[model samples]
Target: MSLLFNSYPLARSALFSLDAETAHELTLSSLQKAYDCRLTRGLMASRPEKPCRLMGLSFRNPIGLAAGLDKNGAHIDALGNLGFGFVEVGTVTPKPQPGNPKPRMFRLPRAEALINRLGFNNKGLDAFIANVRKSEWRNHGGILGLNIGKNAATPIERAVDDYLIGLEGVYPHADYVTVNISSPNTQNLRALQGQEELTGLLAPLQEKRKALADLHGRHVPMVVKIAPDLDIEQIDIIAALLPRYGVDGVIATNTTLSRESVRGLPHAGETGGLSGPPVHALSLRVIERLRGQLGIAFPIIGVGGVVSGKQAQEKTAAGANAIQLYTGLIYRGPALIGECVRALG
Candidate 1:
């Protein structure tokens, strides 16, 4: 094991002592420095290649670092070194905005969960694209997924405009672009998931994507990230529409507003989406239903509550073509990446 992995337990202890968002910012900043100095290279555990194809792109492995960890795409090289098959960044908007007030993020250690209402706080498209262009990983063949969203001030009805701007801005840089209409933090963002609203949103986006493909001479697959709070009926509706709209893939879950699992835990009543072990079964159920509805060929990226190798395998067994991690990284460190990769293999 590398020294960084060996020291994480101690590091986690110290990080856990601080507030959640503070610790998160500190960690990302440190990682940015480590990556810039090349200190993070070769620190991850070695794993044999287990390449897989998804959404017309080849992934080095099926395990990916989920979005929201590096909203600006600033830590791509550093995070890429952590053994993730791919690294997804941003929930960026067309313009920068300060998200919800402080203390918006809460940690539920007992449930191995986190509740966050930090509405798509990011440096916006220009800064985000600049960061992506500066990343060394871009030239080195890292599978990068850029997640885009509407600004908080944008009305729900006009949300498609923001998404179009975001798509145009990051289309050339991303291996795949995730349309993040599922984050609970943004007011009424989930409204876009409705049958009429979803179609209205996806149809034009698909047309624009075709134009972008023609302009760039490369087709970048567009995936939709959905919430885990939906029922089987809703999942089936989404599955049916995806292929109709020419969507390349679907990320089965973002986070959930349901608080059934952590009802009595600290911060359980916080108004935001809950992620981690509490959302695991819900995510699996969505993936299972999506697979059944979309058939075996359509791609599904499963996320929520994957903190161990066992959970990672369970996601694949439940019908995930690929898996992503976020809350798990908060609790397990980078070692979890290799654990999931080896388990998936």
Candidate 2:
């Protein structure tokens, strides 16, 4: 192991001392600098060879970094070197969004969680694609997934327009495109998960995907990232619709609105989606329910609250074809990726 890998605890201490979003920006900036000088590769721990194929694409390992961590994909190469098999970027919208407001992201250290209402903040699809083109991670055979969402200003009824614009824009560049309708930060965003609303969203997107596939001469997969706060009936509805719309896969969860696990903890009352250890069980339950309904052949990417290798193992055991991390990476650093990969392998 390199010194940086072993010294992450100390580094995290310095980072945690800053404001949550400030710390986020500083970390990515430093990481991007380290990557530019080729310092990240040697600083990383050994990555185990644990290959898996999904969504008609081959992954170098089953451990992937979830979307939120590198929203605009400005640091894909830097993050990919940390030993992830795949790196997903964005919840990028059709247009620029300022997101909710300051103090929108709060740390729940006692609960090993964070609550954020960032509301898909980004420089918009055009800048997002520009950043994506600048990345060289694909030269190393790294898998990249582009996650898309509607702008916060866009009304709920016309949300499909934004998603279609996103899908079409990112289709040719992405290894897979993720339609993210599950984020709790955006007002009325999760309503798209409802039965009639979901049908209205997926039907048109699939039609666009088919046309795009023919236009580009390649069928880029479409995966839906869902929320953890769901009942069995909702899971069934989503599972049934996925096949009906030719959806390629499902990401078992986004964040949660529930604070049942961290009720008394500081920042517990904050109004945003919670993510970390508290969400592990809820995410697992959803994964299990999704597995049961979607069947064994369906692709399910498990995420949320995997703060340990044991949890990563549990995700796969509970029927996840693969696993991802975000909050866990915040607490444990880059080493968490290799640890999860070794456990899964």
How much does candidate 2 score in TM-score? 0.98
Q: Write the per-residue lDDT of candidate 2 for residues 121-197, one digit (tens) a residue.
A: 89999999999999888888899999999998899999999999999999989999999999999999999999999
- lDDT value, candidate 2, whole model: 0.92
Note the clash tally of each candidate.
0, 0
The regions of model 2 sitting more than 4 angstroms off are none
Q: What TM-score goes with each of the models?
A: 0.98, 0.98
User: Which 10 successive residues of model 2 have the least lDDT summed?
Assistant: 38-47
What lDDT is obtained when candidate 1 is compared to the true structure? 0.91
Question: Cα RMSD (Å) per model?
Answer: 1.2, 1.0
lDDT of 1 by residue, 1-345 (tens): 578876888999999999999999999888767766754555543343689888888888899989999999988888887777888999999999999998899999999899999999998899999999988765665699999999999999999999999999999999999999899999999989889999999999999999999999999999999999998788888999999999999997999999998998889999988999999999999999999999999999999999999999999999999999999999998888888988987
lDDT, each prediction: 0.91, 0.92
